[model samples]
Target: MISINNLTFEIGSRALYDEANWHIKPGDKVGLIGANGAGKSTLLRLIVGQYAPTSGTISMAKDLKIGYLNQDLLSYHSDKSILYVAMEAFERQNQLHAEIEDLLAKLETDYSDDILNKLSDRQLEFEALDGYNVEFKAHEILAGLGFSEEEQKRPLATFSGGWRMRVMLAKILLQTPDILLLDEPTNHMDLPSIKWLENYLQAFDGAIVIVSHDRYFLDRIIKKTVESRKGKLTLYAGNYSFYLEEKELRNELQANQFKNQQAKIKQEERLIERFRAKASKAKMAQSRIKALDRMERIEDVDDDNPTVNFSFKFSKPSGRHVVTLDHISKSYPNLEILKNTSAIIEKGDKIALIGANGKGKSTLLRIVAGADNQFEGKSEHGHNVSQTFFAQHQLEALHLENSILAELQAFAPKHTETELRSILGCFLFTGDDAFKKIKVLSGGEKSRVALAKALTADANFLALDEPTNHLDMQSVNILIQALQQFEGTFIVVSHDRYFLDHVANKIWYIEDKEIKEYPGTYQEYEEWASKRLVKTEVKPEKKVKEEPKVKKEKQAPSEDRTRLLSKKNKELSTLEKKIEEQEISVKDLEQKLADEAVYSDATKLQETTRAYNSAKAELTHYQEQWEQLAEEIMELEND
Candidate 1:
């Protein structure tokens, strides 16, 4: 759909891409990946016409629609509801609605055949585009993106920059252009919302050229990987995993070749040095010199920025059942985010609390950690559940007037400057960087400082909300590993799929105003939730008849397509209804399991847990069956 020919983008005395050529064809889900300063986002901007390349050209198919989700939110006019902003994407549909409304008013005044004909055309166009269902589709998109119905009604200006980015994302999605240019699109999203986006893109027929640092998201969605580095573009035929393996092999091959060349040169240099001193071997010495001169030197491959390595260790351990919420509920005058939700967090639980934005995930964390007391929740802290809360907004709590070194000192006053600076180095803050004032640090830098402070604190229970927001990929990995190894219990509210899958043994899915706990990784949760009831009803399209110009006779299907499609469709519908009923049954059983009376009876508790788990497994089994049936239906229809 788009082409980049001999592209060369430079920034005064520095070149990001030079003579780089790449083509983006239809149905290609390409992951544009590189380090932080590798110009990935800049390249997206160049493609979107925000900034022109220094040289070369980016061309797209004529009149093709291209939707772009900028890494940074663009400025807008006065306050508008999120729903209104998202609906703005369907420009034609909205315009048609307005026109139809105006026409209806005009008809009340007076009407003619000319006006009637115009109204008919407009109505046909509206119906053709499914304009009547725009509101329902918009609402679904908003809800999938993690905005509650009430939150959707709020003015756009009321949201933070991150949430506002979601609104922009919703806008681009509703557009459904031929090509989608998303730059770090998952930056502000939570885990559940990211999953929704993954499913959204999975069904999207258009090509996607995305620049993202999110590893798991890329691994799941991207079919081709493009690495931009050192003024060059490297293309991989497969996903990020394939790219990693191929890059490693290429590096090793180059290293071996480089070593062999160096060895040959050393041998030649020694021979020449010995022969040069002896006139008897003058010819040999000359030959060695020529060989050395003709030898092609191997290029040294070094990373532009060194990877940051760090680990966090807890100073103490929290008691078993570190925090527990009994009959907790939260409401913001108009919206009740949570309702009588109860959970018991144990020590070393390593829970990943995932949900859409503004769904009480943060509120629950605050309530449990005793950070917010206004909520209606009976939170019981176990013996010495000393809490350490880390949030994106809490970075402001750091004294901007103080230097990073000074901040760490405040966390651990006993640690000397040398010790504190060493720890700072692990977080990518070195010598002079350690001395930099907290006031001058970027959001990412401040996040690192806040994390450094939190890690050093003498707390056992950690309540982290979007902790990896500002950290780079390497830092995220390191933090995940550290959390995995940490002795204390922690509840991390993050959208990082890889981090969540690797770190959290338990997932608390907060959705539909309820907290449902699942004892598994995010991937496992996906395996369980993949059971969306399939709709099997298929309507035949209006097929055009052929003209009589040596036309061949059409053969009717002899029990090949229609019957098989109908059978699979019927089976899928039945299984879907059954699964829906099974889900409800499991929910009731789960509620029973949560009852104090059930737990009081040990036999009943065991039976209920086993039954609930089995019922849940059965639901997934039915979903698997539906998946197979759907596949069969698609195959028959395609054939």
Candidate 2:
């Protein structure tokens, strides 16, 4: 547990935290949210003692342990295996094991009681600390973070910065500190690893403070939301969604108060003017004016959520089919990315390509963008299909010497400076900010500039790879709104579920070296995929043998017909009731799939998916039975 009281942190003349106070209680799952420059990461650094507060206190429990994960860990490198690095969290256990090994080696030369006694002591300590299972725990955490068994054994130095960051995350998770301070922990993660981390954090026994731009991730795991805005930390009792609603309500209340105050001031001003004209009330007017001057003013709410008023347009519309891949086959050494995979991108299609990491989502995007020609396939673009490709590398492609406005001007030569600035305004770069050099911008700012450039190109088709990578929640919403209003075709690759759900009308995923399409929103695709997963996991049941039927005794035709009709009607009634109940069950399961708690947990998702699938099957069977019974009764009555 940690307590931050009246914290005032200043960087030069600007204060990031001005008398901000927050208490992170034991077992609290807090989501630290704000705009990109609102000091979320800086607060994390202050909590971990990397940066000292200018005033006030950040106090922690005497025995409380904290683990902080930040982007700076990307610079970490080790020649040792990542598994070994992660297991280093068990410092005492590792030390005991080393001593025990040393003692065993000594025993080969001399069998003294002291040596034997030391070995026995070390072994006891190792067993007590559960030293033997350290490797297994390390391996599990590493694998969950997306490192394979073989990859875990590879030297940490061989991995890229993002992969190394994941290894650091694994190390922090293995440590299981009493409290965790994670800043953008989902930055380098894929959807699968992000889900795995969500489940892990949901079950974590310690307090957690996460600063993430991922809305879906925050909604899934965090119970409390803390917004860092205007140099103050405001707490919300619920998750990100709840924070948005609560903030809107507070803003409305503040706006009303401000309006009432302004009206009262105006009425008083008119009275003062009248009183000043009369000698008798001049003194009273003077006193009232002084009181009014001393009164505290109410500040009106600022508009934080800016709307995207700029519409995206292209010079010429593409043909019906924007792009086509004919039997595309691409492979790398010991890895088959895609084989005989064929797909089409229509002019109006808004596709979201998503899956786990190393699944070639980016590669396929490149193939569609025509950036890569080494793959064996006929990738054809429809007539008038002008395309713009945006990827992480585009950030590096930006000219460091040019201003943001100048950069846009160069990328879109046809657009006037006014039009380019208008597009930049939608991306949150205002009048003077647009004139700032690209080198002076932060990672998120640079990403916004790059995104704005991509949108400005008069292309009918867009292939965006991780376009929301460094954007804040507000910026992401802007991009979402722009894409929603876009009239051209696009296929985007992103791991942000919330962004995808809002921007994509169709889902594309690669499975077994083939591209699969789900013609619905991301949420719909997830529910369907869950059922498909359950189906694959379930085994077939053996057929039971049926006994020979016994013939009934002969009866009067009228009586037999009446009895058969009655039986059929009763069965039909029962089937109808069952069908109704199954429908309810299916609806309930669908609701559960939409619930954050159910979808965030693997066990719950699996259980709910299985139940949903079963309910659907039962509903089908009952409907069939009802129809058969109804037909039989109709036939009997007619006879």
Question: How close is each model in CA RMSD to the real structure?
Answer: 15.9, 12.5
- Model 2 regions more than 4 Å off: 540-639
Q: Against the unseen true structure, what C-alpha lDDT does each candidate score?
A: 0.82, 0.90
Per-residue C-alpha lDDT of model 1 across residues 330-410, encoded as one tens digit per residue: 889887988887889998888988876667888878887788887676889998777789988788789988989988998
Candidate 2 weakest ten by summed lDDT: 542-551
lDDT of 2 by residue, 457-513 (tens): 998899999998989999999999999999999999999999999999889899889
Q: What does candidate 2 score on TM?
A: 0.84
Q: Which window of ten consecutive residues has the lowest lDDT sum in model 1?
A: 533-542
Stretches > 4 Å off in candidate 1: 93-136, 147-154, 278-295, 300-321, 324-331, 334-344, 375-380, 383-386, 416-418, 509-517, 528-639
TM-score (C-alpha, index-matched) for candidate 1: 0.74
